[model samples]
Target: MQPGKILVAEQDGAFVIKLVGEVRLTLCTTMDDFFDDMLTSKGFASVVIDLVDATNIDSTTLGLLAKLAIKAKQRFSYVPVILSTNPDITRVLDSMGFDRVFCIRQEPVVDDEDLNELPVLPDSEDAVRAKVLEAHRVLMGMNDSNRAKFRELVTLLEGQCY
Candidate 1:
C-alpha cells in the first residue's frame, strides 16, 4: 500500500488539505501537529479537506478528522469543511453527527492558495441553501447502484462510529 500522506494548500483565505494514499494511524500525529501549528497562525476562514485520492482510511484517521473539525471551530471561529469521494468517510461523518459541523463539498477546492483571501459568505441565506441543494443534487446523481452501495456503507459506518 502507498504510504499515507496529507498535503496542505490554501487559497482565497481558505485552507485545503488533501489526503492521499492510505490513511491510518501513521498520520494521526502528523495531522495533530499540523493543526496545532495552525492554531496561532493567521487562521483561515474556511478549511477544506480533499479526499478524492485516498485509497483507504481507517478509524483513527476519521477520529483525527473529527478532532481537527472541533479544534478548527474553537481556534478559528469556523467549522472545518471537507471534500470526500470516499462514501465510507461521508457516511461516517453523517453517522457521527458531523453533518451539523463540517460543510461537505462535492468537488475538492481547486485553488492551491485559498488562504490569500477571506472566505466569502453567500449573499443570501437562500443562496447558501441553494448551494447546499445543488451539492446534494450532484451527490445524488451518482449511479443508483453506487448510491445503494453508499447507503450500505452508511449503515456499516454508523455501527462503527463512536
Candidate 2:
C-alpha cells in the first residue's frame, strides 16, 4: 500500500478531512492535534471525513476517528459525516460502531478543489504512545465488542511508562 496522507480544507467553519493511501498509528498524533484545533476553533460547525481514497485504515486510525466523532457530539451536539465508498472499509466502520457516532455516507464529497495535504507534525515518542492509548480507550468506550477487542492492547499500553 502507498504511504498515508491526510488532506484537509475548511470553508465557513465546515471542515473536510480526506484520508488517502494507508492510514495507521503513525499519523495519529497529527490527526489528534488537528481534531483538537478544529473542534475548538471559532465558528466551528461541522466535519466531514472522506475515506474514498484510503486503501487501508488501521485500528489506531479508526480509534482516533472515533475520538473525533465522540468529542464533536459531546461538545457541540454535532455528529460528523464520514464518506466511505469501499466495501471493505465500510464493513470495518460498521463493525466498529461508527454508524452510531457518525453519519456514514457512500458518496464522494463535492467542491474539494481547496483540499490541501496536511503536514505531518512531529511528536515525542511518549506523546505518540499516549495518543495511541487514549485513542484505543475511546474506541473501547464505543461498544462492547471494541472493549473486548482492545482490552489487552490498552492494558499493555497502560502498563508501559514511555
Candidate 3:
C-alpha cells in the first residue's frame, strides 16, 4: 500500500497541500491521519490541494476530502480548497454532488481565461508566489512534452498580471 503523500507549504495565510502519487484505497489511512492532524490545528485561513502529481485517485479519498470541506465550513474563519484534475474522478465527484461541496474544478491545463478563476487572494503576495511556484513545480515534474505547455501557461499568467 502506497502511503498517501501530502506536502505542505504556506501561501498568504493559507496552507497548500500537494497530494502526489497514487491516492487510492491503500493510502486512505495515511491521508486520514494527515487531515486529522490539520483539523486539530489552528492558523490557516484556507487550504489548497494541488493534485498535479496525482496519477490515480479513488472515491475513498474523494469522500474523505469532501468531509473535510464540510467540517471546515463549520468554522467561521477558514475553508479547505480542493484541487483535482483526473477527469474520471472529477466527473464522479461532480455527479455525486461533491463538486459544489468542495469547489472541485478541473486542473488548469493551459494559460487562458480559465486561469483567472484561480484563488489568488490578492491581499497576499506571498500566497500568489506560492501558488505560482507550486504550479511551475508541478509542470516541471511533468513529462518533457507537458512541460512546454505549462511554461506557456506561466508566460500567459505573467502577461495578465496586474
Once fitted onto the true fold, the runs of candidate 1 whose alpha carbons sit more than 4 angstroms away are 11-13, 111-162
lDDT of each: 0.59, 0.94, 0.55
In Å, residue 12's CA in model 3 sits off its true spot by: 6.1
TM-score of each: 0.61, 0.97, 0.55
Q: Per-residue lDDT tens digits of candidate 2, residues 33-138?
A: 9999999999999999999999999888999999999999999999999999999999999999999999999999876779999899999888889988998999
Q: Cα RMSD for candidate 2? A: 1.0
Q: Candidate 3 regions off by >4 Å?
A: 1-4, 11-13, 77-79, 107-162
Better of 2 and 3 by TM-score: 2
C-alpha lDDT of residue 33 in model 3 = 54
Pairs that clash in candidate 3: none
- Tell me, by TM-score, which candidate is best: 2
For residue 138, model 2's alpha carbon misses the true position, in angstroms, by: 0.5
